[model samples]
Target chain A: MAKFDISNIDRRWIYITILLGALLPLFVPITFAPKISPEVKAVYDYIDKLPPGSVILLSFDYGPSTLPETEPMAEDIMKHAFINGVRVIGISLTEEGALLALKAYSNVVKEFENYGTIRVNYGYDFVFLGYKSGRQAVILSIGEDIRKTFPTDYQGTNIDDIPMMFNVKNYKDISLVVDISSTNTPNDWITYAYSRYKVPVAVGVTAVLAANYYPFIQTGQIIGLIGGVKGASEYEYLVNQKIQSNWGMKPKRIPAMRNMSALTVAELLIVLFIILGNIGYFSQKGNKRR
Target chain B: MAISSSIWVWIAAFLTLAVFSFLYKDNIIYKMVEALFVGVSAGYSIVIILKHSFVPNIWKPLFVSHNLLYLIPFLLGLLFFAMLSRKTAYLTHIPFAFLIGSGAGFALPLVFQTNVMAQVKGTMLFAPSHYPSLGAFINALIIFIGVLTVLFYFFFSRGEKTNRGIIVKTGIAFIMIGFGASFGYTVMARLSLLVGRLYFLFGTWLGILH
Candidate 1:
């Protein structure tokens, strides 16, 4: 180990370490056994249990800023739903999320294109409702009437024209509302959608927002949570495993699972830094006492 | 390794690098990128709102459908533009008040039901039969206790300073743990963003690590 005061270590050195930790794994990947947590499993189980043709409304409540963390979640959940015959209705409460949702859905659909057995058609299997203002209002309106909330899909196709949306009207049509959020949009969903309408809501949020939902999750207000990238990795692992077993499909190492190596290494470096910092503080304090 | 040939990819890579350049030191490139980001975001957002919300929700309904009820919100929305005029700037406050009033009115009951009543149910409905195991039940019970103590601390914090009980100390402990967990997540978030950018530079632009 290098002999240097961690407390007084240059910020650039720390940044470089993080950069290296992140960069190295991408070039030469290393992955561990993805441990599935109960909360995440709860979400997976809920979706898995939904009968074919059951609709899941997934909200891309995040943008480019938190895309790396959240985008994987969207992919995992949508893939699971698509794998089963369960349909999905994509929506975004945030403006940035609207296009991002479409992009994510497109990417997932592209991946599904590889599998000859799996087929997902736009406006039939899934629909992206695009962005709407008034987060809570939008949620409540979806509860009352989804068609009124989103008259047209992202591609400007009328809701009535979409075959899948023929029977879809409100919360009753939606088996679950999963919000992948970087912001507090999940809280709004829980408040307006879950609490008011008694709709089941799950959340995949940025790491920071995950902790804030402890009370909600504990109360069973939000049924499942994909906390952060770690949670996403768990999901990717789950999907990969299931698809491999049931469908005999080759496992595609999804982004979250792929990035887990880098994340682990980076997090380890952070832990090392913290340890060094504490040691430096203790040594300094001892010297002062002498 | 092949570099990205598309002009758009090149532009994106350049912008991503320009933003990352701040890690070394602040420079004109970073500043320019920052300015461009803010300006573009604001402009794009306004366009999106108009096309998605204004045209479809308000304008089409009021004009095409001949819905008189839509006129109320439309008129109130018009008041927002008054901010551009010094003489009529006060009118902006009317819409602001209306927005706040209605939003609060709409949210009050739902917010209460979710945050308070639901939380109470979670804390109270700690039946051992609900748990899969004793350990899970205990964990739930601990959380149940922590909730009460934390709430007690919050309510008591505004009062006298003389009697700081054991419950207050426990509450402080829980609060500290919460803050610490939040800080850890914050670190994770920042690092996640970095990993994403590096992925873009290496995987997308450089085409080495895809």
Candidate 2:
């Protein structure tokens, strides 16, 4: 407890401190470990049990602002689906997200070579349905008729032309609906996917939005949830541990792990700062009273 | 033909920058991009609705199958367009009411299954007799404590009671810590987008990373 003037500390310095603390880890490359909470573990296990050729509807319901947290999750989940031979039908709720989803999908598809073949391919193995709006209306129609919701892929190919959508009759046929969102889009998924059609639903949401979903997870509306990047990283870790062990892949646990490390240190510092500010304010009050 | 990569890169960079412009000030550039985003999204949604829902469900059955039953849904959809017509807008209420009713009906059963029943089942624990191992026991205890403590923090009815003061205090502390971590992580997540934007500018435009 040094008698230092806490009020004199510049806010910019704190931001700098946090920024450097976070970014430095990326280059240094220490092991970024996750606490691996039960909810995340459940999501990991559910996806693990999915058989190859199982249709998973992945809605990338996040815009660019949330890509930092959500992109890694989407990438990791798609990677798992690819490696496990699961057929992924990608779509987006927000218009801006459609291109980003495709870009991320293509990037993961490209990286598939470096990690070796996961026995999956685009069009044949997976499909991108692009972006559709109307929120719950779009999802409800999709439950009854997918061809009605998306007549073509983002590229404007006929839905029937894509082999992936052939067996995708309705939401009932979908194995799992994984709504990867930056906001509350998962609520709509729960209403339309699980409520209307009784399809199993999972969510990968931003950390801020994850708390509101506890009720859904509790009720069985959501089979499991991957909260933000950490959840995504955990899923990647589990999948890599299970299937990719023979190939010698260490898993891409970056982004989440590194970010979490910085976050922990920053939290401790901010709490300490807040406590010091309180102490300073109380002490000044006592002096004034005297 | 596919849109050129350079052209996409430029568009992405500009839109990304325009979004970031909100951090400084909401200028005409930001407004223009925002408006375009809205217009494009609205147009795209109309196309998707026509292709996905309208054609297969309404148009195809009406025109090809020549089924009179298809008229019900087609007319219902058309009624939704009545929302746009201010004079006869009250007619639009039928479709809106059906949508709300259907959506609510969908949510009720699911809310029970997923939120209430499933959660109750999930929380129903093992008889520690089965999980005699230290690690398993500790994990279960930690989860039990975390759940109860978090709940206790929200229960303000008996909050001032001194009997469970320590537990409540600990619970409140845990909640604060959780909030701190969540907030800090969210900041990093948002900042990461800014990082991605910077990467696009430098790596894609200036060829710095390459």
Candidate 3:
């Protein structure tokens, strides 16, 4: 047997172990039912309480790189909103998030039909103001007047032509502004939208950024946060629970929930490696001292 | 298990595998994909901006509608290109000044309110009287202590030699907690991204997961 040395171990071997740890759960699935955290429930509760036809301004502020985290969060929220008859006005802060938002909306809307829930019309019930440049400037503009910022929806149909546009003029008309972000755009929402316009803001942030927002949540600047894939899984569980109870069927696919198993096993494996590496380091140091 | 037949799925799977090939070693395939990603991103941005902003907001309204009012901002925006010439370079500052001025004019008060006043209020409002339960009181007290200590850690991160008091040590502990939480979350996030790709390959592409 080769002598085991922590410092001299092949990087490939470690990478392979981690990869196997992540991959094994996908093959023989380990189900992890996410426990809804207080922060996540705060967001869910806020959205859950909105009256039918109330508009949720969902800013898709993430790119494809974070689709694993943000996309499911967006989809879960949109599904909840649709299921509750709460309309969503999807916009994108990041350029890539524009198309990503459109894709998410389309996916949810397709599934919405089968829920046999209330009809979700494109122009009337929901509308996408789409991507506009000048991220902070666009957010501030939307605070003042959304129509001036986005003359047309993503499809280039004038906002005046859209039925829902008549009722939604600015932040005042929005029931909630949920910025799903992997960027600092949520900070802009917190500062501009919530601070100036006094609109309630919630964030669905990538897990890495979640720590940054805990203080903001404490200050009540943000109503709640859905932090990363784990947060998304918790949210999916919550949404599916309510949705299933109401309709007697869970949402067809739970991607984020599936992700939890891999996330758990991978973390556990990495922790074990870290512990073993530390033990080996101390043991080697003791030998040197001797 | 059946393999995915869709061309898009095949393209995506191939690109994903190509990117993952970096774990072994940096090769031409990775380089090619990296360049391809950048080019596609740049091209995508141009198409989105032109289709969404320039066309609807400026181009159509200026030329088709013959709206001369749009020309003011348009001409100001064009001055940004003046940076190409030495003498005309200073002209770029005109629009830059407007942008900065207007942005500051709008943002100054709001930023103060959100970042300062709100945060301060959240911190300072942690009185024991406000808490109805022992647990709530302890949580609030802990938060109050954590916020104060961590605020000082910001100065510590700048390499300032503050007084070596228990307060500073406490702040260091709070900072470590924050860092640990952040690191743990980052690990979960990166792992989730990997899980996503692995699932795409195994479940979506190969159908082996089923």
Candidate 4:
């Protein structure tokens, strides 16, 4: 057989392969049914069971750098809340996340409008409290008084003027707290919100950080977690399932679902590269032995 | 292929391609976009910090709301800039002391409650009689063993000869498995980001995919 060499393979070729793996899937649509993990299910079930008009706090704690992994989870969770008639109180602990929070809200609200059934009015049904400094201090203060921490919403509108803020004074009024983050904000939430106020906490984090939070989940400090794109896809699947079953609504195609095929292709390419590299190493070792 | 009509979409597409060009080789386009991104991000962060945090919490409270108590924090914050001046740098120490002291004091109890006590409680292998199940028993046992082994692996106080026990070997295995899983998840995370960018290029900017 012709000599098989992976060691000398051009790096550009690998890049092209990866690019193709990511790009081709967009042209040929493929659907992936995510195996919804227990953690993801817990999040879905908790939000699903919340009473109508219950206030849910969403802390967007990521920047544009993590938008891909974080945004889908944010969108899906917001959609679920809106569909379930749950009031959303949005906040961002990170400066970069402030714009992202608004974008996520706007995207979900636009999609919700397409349903033409549930009307969501800004400052009434939902509000974005925007970014705050003193990360841990802000979180602790919010546990005591949200209005005190955020005197006004993102648009410079007074919190007192917002109808949704009427009952939401602190974590006491909130049903659940979901933080979508690329950093250690979830840990802060667990330490401050859950440990102190006994508020239910959930997190949607990048996959790399997901493993670190399992200990928190095991301790029941975090009610649920949705990690990275797979987690986002699973959540999207759950939300779509709920909307379909409850309202008999047609499920809209979400970004997470669309991008999963590309992820699969990229993963397969990586695996292939790993196998090839190993084969090359072994083959060279055998030659040396000769 | 159908192209986009929107000027913003074209701009986004151009920027995406410019950034992606770094995969082949770094060029002026990539450098320009990178600088633009950094400049925009820094400028935006300053604006947001001023509008949301400083204005609402410090400025408005001090001036508009006339909450005199806010002046303390306001002054402390201003002292942060004092570090730039050699003469006034001593003032920075006061705020730094207060910050470090208060932060540690606040975080101490909370960290102990969540990270220490809660983690220890979660590692308890002895299950209560009410929720007796074989699966739970096995899972708890595994977790308990894993935690101990992992901890033992990091115990460098013991001599190498003493630490070469079967328990240490098992700890190595568990650590390896943990590392492998982390590696796998990290790969997944990176691929997800790539998929996201491709989707944006094709689905959003190009509008060729549905």
Candidate 5:
């Protein structure tokens, strides 16, 4: 083998390699099918088992910075909920998350419309409760009364006017709470909503925060979890396999699945670089010993 | 290659390229876009906070509904501005104290129940016999041992030399495994973000890929 010195490699070359690893997969046609983790499957099973018309509170707790990973998860969950006839009540605990929630809701609604099957009536089927201040306080207040916490929807329309708000009072009426966040909002949900109200909580978080939540899941404090884009892809795959089939709809191209190829390639390239660097280090050390 | 016609797409593509340019070298374009992002986000946050929070919760309740009870929170909120001045800064302490006290009081019990008590209860209630499958029983046993060893590692009172460093070594091994998993997930998270930007640039903006 030719002599190699990884330490002498330029940083620019590494960047170029990673850039190619990310970009080439986009141009080249390939499919990335990830094996669904048990954690992600747990989330799928919980939502799948919920009876029709059951209310699910989706807390969009992330901003644009984490839109890449969390948005796909949010969209997939919303799509699954809509397909299964589950009632969705959306809220954002963070100010930056408000618009993101609206965007995701609108995108999924548009997708449903494109499907030309079930038309979701806004006030009856779903409602965006909009953003509220006081992160943990808002969660606690939601346990008591949702209307009092969010007096109006995102459009300044009163919650009383919204037809769906009639029967929904608090966590009692809701089936589950799924928090898709980049922050500690999931922990707060577990603390306030799950611990106090006995409501089941699920989370879709950035991958960095995924391991932190495993202890909670092991303890049954959290019902399920979806982590990062891979987690989102798993959900998309499950929805297409199970939920979409029931709807008699063909499996569509999911953004998360499409992006997974690049993710895999980039990660593999990183691993290769690490191995090469280690080999070069050991080889240099052996030469010095000689 | 076909170019996008929409002015907004063009703008987005340009901004995306400008941001990506940072990978090669820092330039004025990167700085300009960075500044714009910060300014726009800050402005958007103010509007959102005003619309969703201040107007609904504080302003409308106090002025329109004429609820005097809202005055307490309104005044307390104003006390935050007192931090800007030295002479009147002492007034800020009252609100600060209330905030800290109320926040701590509210969070204490919940944290105890969810983070502490619930976790302990879960560990204590682990019954491998309850599992239907042998695989599940083994998994539960592994979890039980892992939790104990991890907890033992954190016990500072027991010196490492007491147990011939065996328990401490086991704890270190588990800790290393946890750190490795965390590192792996972090890499995946960052790669996912990169994939997102690439998707936007190629799939959404440029329409280079379908």
Candidate 6:
């Protein structure tokens, strides 16, 4: 048999072990305490404080590539907004995001329908304005004239034609702008919407993009922020709503939890491997010393 | 059995697991998953662009209404196919440059105000009235200090031997912690996504567990 090589034998074994650990959670769905940070809690409380019929604008700026993270955030925020009777106007910055946002809304709306209370539809209570180009330019223009940005809704109905557009004017009229985005357009909302228009801006950002907004959160330029899936799950927990589940708790949380279970075993294996590697290094060093 | 809408969910679940398998080995399985993702994503984007952008802005305006200005986008859209024509490939640059120029023109000022000006203005325009608690004050102070020191550390005029050395180091530490926390949180987030796929497969689709 060839000499046992810990470094280069095969990395697949480690992956298989990890995969098994992660898979165990699907069967045993355990509820765990989520460490809700102040930033996340602020977002929860901000939405909770809104009066019924307050207009909330949600920008779905992510494509299918980031659907796993942004979708749940969009879902929960929509669920919360509707449950609280806050009018939600869904918009998309990315062209692809329009479909994703619509799909997410309908998915959650169907679930919302199961409760037999809220009768949410496309044109009535919620309006999906679909994709608009010009990026930040659109955000800026909408502050002055929403009609200029959205001349027509997704279905070709003029803004004036829609009843919901009656009270909706500019960013000032919007109670909060929850930016569910992968890009930095949320910063534009903070600039034009929050800073310029004084509309409180909340962000539901991918985990990678969340840190950039922390400074804004600390300074109160952004009222609240939801960072990635964990943040989404945390927000879901606080609202007593299930947006997207089993992402963390099932595959990830279970593996992580099970990892804690077989942690001692893995630790011992690692220690043994490390000690052996060290011995090999030291033995070579001793030979050179002579 | 009916190849219902939920079958897409199952296909998605399987694709997710297949992609996750790459963590174990970068073999044919992972490559197949990667290729499938690339194909599906391209197909999806094409559909989205045609349905959402092309039809709404270009086709409807040009052919349906006979709007002459819509010809510009039509011509620009045609520029996308120039790359396929090897001899006239440079024509792609016209549209490319237009896109790049317009994208920059749209984004630059906004970036300047939002990312640079707004953030700086926010830092300077702080009021202590918001949070009366000492903890809030301390946090604000720390954030202010962190910003200043991190900025100073990049300054070439004053070397590490300056009076601000300790402050700079402390700032660096805070920045590092913030970055590290962000990174750790992101890892957990991605892990959550993988977990979500597994849940769909095991709990919802297969019904292996109650």
**Best model number under TM-score:** 1
What DockQ does model 1 achieve?
A: 0.78
TM-score against native, each model: 0.95, 0.72, 0.94, 0.94, 0.94, 0.78
Candidate 4, residue A186: the lDDT equals 97
Model 2 score (lDDT): 0.73
When summed lDDT is taken over every stretch of 10 residues in candidate 3 chain B, the lowest stretch is B155-164
Best-performing candidate as measured by lDDT: 1
lDDT tens string, model 5, A31-72? Answer: 777899998999889988999989999999998877889998
Off by over 4 Å in 5: A1-4, B125-127, B157-164
> What lDDT would each prediction earn against the true structure?
0.88, 0.73, 0.88, 0.87, 0.87, 0.72
Candidate 2, which CAPRI tier?
incorrect
Relative to the unseen true structure, what is the C-alpha lDDT of residue A5 in candidate 5, on a scale of 0 to 100?
75
Candidate 6 residue-wise lDDT at A208: 80
Residue ranges of candidate 2 with Cα displaced over 4 Å: A1-5, A8-38, A49-54, A93-97, A114-119, A130-175, A188-200, A214-223, A237-244, A249-290, B1-89, B120-185
Model 5 per-residue lDDT at A45: 90
lDDT of 2 at A36: 79
Instruction: Please say which candidate is ahead in TM-score: 2 or 5.
Output: 5
Residue pairs in steric clash, candidate 2?
A148-B52, A148-B53, A149-B52, A218-B119, A219-B113, A219-B114, A219-B115, A219-B116, A220-B114, A221-B114
User: In candidate 4, residue A207 scores what lDDT?
Assistant: 92
lDDT of 1 by residue, B1-210 (tens): 688898998899999989989989999999999999999999989998998889998999999999999999999999999999999999999999998998999989989998888778778745799898999799888887788889889887666655788998799898999999999888887878888888888888888876
Question: Candidate 2 vs candidate 5: which has greater lDDT?
Answer: 5
True contacts kept of 3: 0.89
Error of 1 at A181 (Å): 1.1
True contacts kept of 6: 0.41
User: Tens digit of lDDT per residue, candidate 2, span A1-290?
Assistant: 86766666666666666555545444455555566777778776777788978888889888776775788788878877777778899988876677789878877877776677465677877789877657877788887889878878878899898888887878877888888898778877876677768888888888778767865665467888887656766665666676557577665535555555545555566677778778878888888899
